[model samples]
Target: MYELTVVVTKVLGTCSSEVPMKPGDYLTVRNGALRIPEGGHICLYALQSLMPVLTTKERRIGEKHSDDWVWRVHHVQCPDPEGRVIFHIVRSGEKAEMPPYTPSEPCPQPQTDPSLADLRVIVEEVRGKCTSGMQPGDGFLLKSGRLYIPAGRHFCLYALQATLPLLPAKQRAPLDGDWLARDNHIICPDPAGNVVLRIERV
Candidate 1:
């Protein structure tokens, strides 16, 4: 697995990952191990080193298919001290946003904002189609970039938003207590956490 530090906005536009250091908008990249889940997740690992940036149709030199340079977003680990892909970073893709860590039980409640009223879902198309707000073709955006959909959940959301569509009339049940919002200030839970996010809301 290749370990490249890319900006979230570049890869995922502005959806914002809950994990930090992603440089994207959605879902923060938890520093660990992961993998390329499926065809829907084909793009996750596609952006690797020396990988050609050609589309599926562009590589057809002839009906014989001479060259095929593809890039799938892989669920690689969060890079180790030697910067290696030695774990599962979860490339759930369009299958489901949060795989591997399936919420065994229902998402716990007050359930924060009912039906995710305060939150906005950025797009997570299976074939790399950007969704709603934050930026044109960027993905989606909540208020001031607080909470965002993780890449792992992209599959679920795509199925839900595209096929099912989580509209006002048919909204799904939301998890309680744990809400995904833009935390301008990351208050240090421990006095000793090797972090550097001192300022609130950059």
Candidate 2:
């Protein structure tokens, strides 16, 4: 995957990134920075992390920014012959690899309503200070320039790999073979901050 950054204007209102990508190009949001003007306010919609993942067809990354938000949107051209692409969100320090293209069965089409799919789990609240001691089913969501994990629990990588298929088609990383090696699970770099996660439909 190729790494790149796009700086969205603060006041221009709903700025689109200059990244040159077509219909099937896969994009992943790895990091971001928001520059809010003094006395300016950041909106709840702008603070959300799942916006980029769910958007397609003239893809937009964020709500109209009151401040400049420079987000790192990594790109990878679709290697499959069918002109289909897969996106993945990985922790900063984890290994990055292309998901294999398996040509046997067709991939499940993504649902319009994310809640109707089993692939997403929204974070309702954090019980403690960004806890990592979560149960086997817990997972983190990468957005808002931070890795948001449960406040008081640790989530295991093995458990995450097992649960990936449960994510909505859009949220789950596409894998050909050896899904465990292909899936990228995110974790909070810091264990002090708290956050709520909403599963975005692919």
Cα lDDT tens digits for candidate 2, 78-180: 3333422223433334465644322122123453333442333443445445433433345454322112334433342222333333343434445567453
Give TM-scores for every candidate, taking all chains together and pairing residue i with residue i: 0.19, 0.23
Candidate 1 residue-wise lDDT, 1-202, digit = tens? 2222222222223222122223221222212211221211121222232122211212223333234223343333322223222222222232323322212122233444454333344322223322211122223223221223334432122122231112221233334642322222222122232111211111
Instruction: State the lDDT at 102 in candidate 2.
Output: 21
* Candidate number of the best lDDT: 2
Give me the runs in candidate 2 sitting further than 4 Å from their true place: 1-75, 84-120, 128-190, 194-202
